[model samples]
Target: MRQWTTGRERAWRLLLIAALAAPAVCFADGDAVTAKAKTSLNIVVGSREARPGKEVSVPVTLQTNGLKPAVLKMTIRFNPAYVSYVEEEDGAAAVGADKVVTAFELPSGSLNVVVAGFNDNAMNDGLLFNVVFYVSNAAPQGTIVPLTCPSGDGVLSAADPLAARLDVTATAGSIEIICKGPPAPNPVAGWFDAQEGAGLTWGESAGAEAYQIYRSEMNDPATAEAVTDWLPSTARQYVDASILANLQDYCRLYYWVRARNAEECASDPGGPVDFVINEIPDAPSGLTATRGHSDGVLLMWNGVPNGAEYRVYRSNNNDPATRQPVSEWMPATFSFMDTTTPAAQYGIAAGCSGRLLLDFFQYTYWVAARHTNGCESDLSEPAQGFRGLPESEAAGVLPERGDLTAWASICVLLMLAHRAWKTRKA
Candidate 1:
């Protein structure tokens, strides 16, 4: 074994010199004693999350890998703007060491830590010391303060027989200062599409830099968690497209929003707004279409539950895709008086050479259910009906129709009335 006892125990400087002067010693395995390793000095402050004016302990840990260190000295730097040093004890100076010395360079915001021992067990793996610090009361929230440990000059050595020199790599850590801000307001769940989920919106906070939305199956805020990490300040709206529509009011969801400021403080949640969902209405069934005595077709269907509106579709042929809504969305009712507007009347008959009055043409009709949220159901069973006419031969309704003489004049006036009818009911 390379003799370390021969050299009189001296200070760390002397030991370093001796270690440098010692010839490369080969062990029985023919391996030299000099084994270089990357050691680390880390600042671990239990939790990086901290509020202003709070005391936090920063543990200076050493990772020598498997190498036993005999002498370790380094400078631990901290940001004075966020934290200030607190303790000066041995454990706080140099942990698990026989001789401990620490130099406080306060103005420079650094702590020079030194520890050495002759016994091989001087410094094992794990923490080397602690630098207790109190978070500055004035520290702004969201500020990430750095705790860096830079390698001091020629300060680390192994406990090997030759006191092999080790390549020490120091790592840095951090402390975060957190604060609070004003809450968001007027959180609302505006709209919902069975396919697109819910649209959530909220009023802005005075100085908020960001926002977050929370959702839960239960009405309580405690059960709710953030749907997103955080949103930019400009984002006052979010669509929770992950939600499924409650067909039978199967389940209800609640939403809330919180604002965050530049200081990283999150305001109190704004609301427990109930999420609005557009449940898909059931298709209207049991449909029947019969020729009217005068100008339109009388159509009837089973009323749909939760159906805020209904749409009537008619096709000249059997193709479902070819069928189109004969009228704009209508109120939820079991029966509808569907009139054949001049637009449908002016079109030439399919088998006939000229335009027929459509008094005897058979049309396939269907009824669909629509929810207030715009979710629509499949079309109902088809029923056949003979010709019908416009409620009033208004000229404006048939603008797109071929304008020929008498029909042209009628089509012109009906357009305005038709648009107005569409704006209200079909």
Candidate 2:
């Protein structure tokens, strides 16, 4: 029984040795079959964040170890959900496995490979590949990309370390306009109150290089005029003092602005504003007056066109007294009657009564013309008049009464005597 047991044990050991030696022999017959694969893959993504309509590039590397002149065929796959083929080059050709492969070339150093593609759809999706190529503008913010490599030969059991995850973000391009001061009023009749220069402001944008400004009159809509030259800096405010004119009876004015890049243009027209002008009235002119009768004075003056009325002033001592309205402003008649006692009491002084009656009297009057628009003329030159005393009582002489031949003779004698004396004194 012990001998039989020993034979069975010998058979078991031989079978174990054969099983181990069989693999070694088989490996020696063909190319040495290493326990692990000699192939390695690495992926690198460029510009994880991208703008719309832009291209992205990815680099891929494959290395072979162990034997010289070893042949390596690498297949790279991209998730169709996330990437689109823009262009491909090298021995790398598209195969049925949703992949591209570079055919065997003797492993020359470490193979440095690169591939690039784009994202055409306006959506975000996960990308899985040894390398990923896509633009991010169409993709949503914060997209993660994973790289993977399938195990190849038993000689290369482990894939290259997974590349760092690539995160994608999207950027946008835009433009805007800004206005500085209040807009000019529409239908501008009188004058523009705008400062020297005023217009809209432009905000920052990605592609815009300059801006254009437009203006039009409210009355004449067909006459749309463009301001000269592009606004140089990003600042979009434009000074348009040149566009305004005097007495332009405009109903409303409109403005429009636009942004431009080398290739594209965007426009924004702000709301319109309405305006009108206010003018001051002209001063009144041609004021004059004339005098009239006993215990009453009639005043008259030339009429001013559009004159509302006239103001009259009277003074007995040449000083300007209170002024009274001759008529309502711009009145049809430019005449007035002065019925005051001072104006009516016009008389000569009586001489040789109990005492010489002194009638020292002078009067002065002024007139001003007013326009309907509230403009007043300068005062007219004063009109003057005077009253004198009678001469009968002067020279301390009296008329003598003569009757019949004798009285007549006496009166003639006295008159002759008085005349002779006055003439001698003169």
TM-score of each: 0.33, 0.23
**Model 1 weakest 10-residue run by lDDT:** 23-32
lDDT of 1 at 391: 37
lDDT at residue 119 of model 1 (Cα atoms) = 71
The window of 10 residues in a row where model 2 has the poorest summed lDDT is 22-31
For candidate 2, give the lDDT of residue 158: 21
lDDT of 1 by residue, 229-263 (tens): 88888987888876654444534567888888776
What lDDT score goes with residue 33 in model 1? Answer: 39
Candidate that would win on TM-score: 1
Candidate 1 wrongly placed segments (more than 4 Å)? 1-47, 88-103, 155-172, 179-426
- Give me the runs in candidate 2 sitting further than 4 Å from their true place: 1-292, 317-330, 343-357, 385-426
